[model samples]
Target: MIQNIINQNAYTALDQEEYQRRYDSLVERFDTTKADLELTTEQIKDKITRHRNLEIFLGELKNQGNLITKFDPLLWNSLVDYATVFEKQKVEINFNSGITIAVK
Candidate 1:
């Protein structure tokens, strides 16, 4: 009876240790994942800001009539290239207020 009690206690202790180890590992992974998510969020925000600035620059260039007939083709090509690259790496942000912004 005492031996049975000893065996049960040992088994319980081993099980508890294993559970603690697994729990610790899970918590560490969660922390790492949270950090990665935060970094990604910041990067997306930066991309949106860059896109907004580019739009403003494009508008200014247009207003200044920098795209004459001779320069139109080159300007169009450059715009197309920019659009393609932006589309390829586009980020979509959906806010809690049900607003969606596409940054490309």
Candidate 2:
């Protein structure tokens, strides 16, 4: 939409004061600025979702104050997204919040 406006006004924008002002405003900015904003917005939303999930995970963890000697199925199901077993005694654990840990 904005690009369309810029394109349609390109002809009359030349040799005009308002157009020159508009051009000057855009001169300091890159055409890809919109894409940059979209990327960062996605990142921020992902981070927010992860943080909320982490909060729930932490709340459940707070119940286990002492050292956890036994495995908790609830914690595992809540925190783990998936696990992949590899050759040579290696396993990769993927968390629900986009984090991975490898164990050997």
Candidate 3:
């Protein structure tokens, strides 16, 4: 889209200033739109990586049998990433599967 706008053929116009104004406006739009596209593409790629990590983690968990009755340090290490504690007893626990839980 940006390239097509930039490479478009131009014909003689009665108003040269008007043509320049429109062309400059298109150039500005092209820059901003290209930046936005790049940002969104990176976000999508990150989400895809996060999702695959979650799928693999869950599959391993599913094969580990029934509920656990004892404290398992290895399991805990595999599941939790880090935790954030805020004021007033508010805490956020981040998991290995890109999920977070807030406790208040």
Instruction: Pick the TM-score winner.
Output: 2
Clashing pairs in 2: none
- For all candidates, what are the clash counts? 0, 0, 0
Pick the winner on lDDT between candidates 1 and 3: 3
Return the candidate ranking by lDDT, descending.
2, 3, 1
Q: Flag clash pairs in model 3.
A: none
lDDT of 2 at 40: 97
Tens-digit lDDT string for candidate 1 (3-98): 444466567765767665666676787789999999999999988866765676577567766446455554444343232124588866543223
lDDT of 2 by residue, 2-64 (tens): 465477577554546776567666754655787789999999999998898889899888988
Off by over 4 Å in 3: 1-15, 71-78, 85-91, 96-99, 102-104
Could you tell me which 10 consecutive residues in candidate 3 have the lowest summed lDDT?
5-14
* Candidate that scores best on lDDT: 2
Candidate 3 per-residue lDDT, tens place, 1-104, comes to: 44544445343433657656777888899899999999999999988977877776677678778887778676676678899999999999998777899999
Ranking by TM-score: 2, 3, 1
Off by over 4 Å in 1: 1-14, 66-104
Off by over 4 Å in 2: 1-31
TM-score list, all predictions: 0.50, 0.62, 0.61
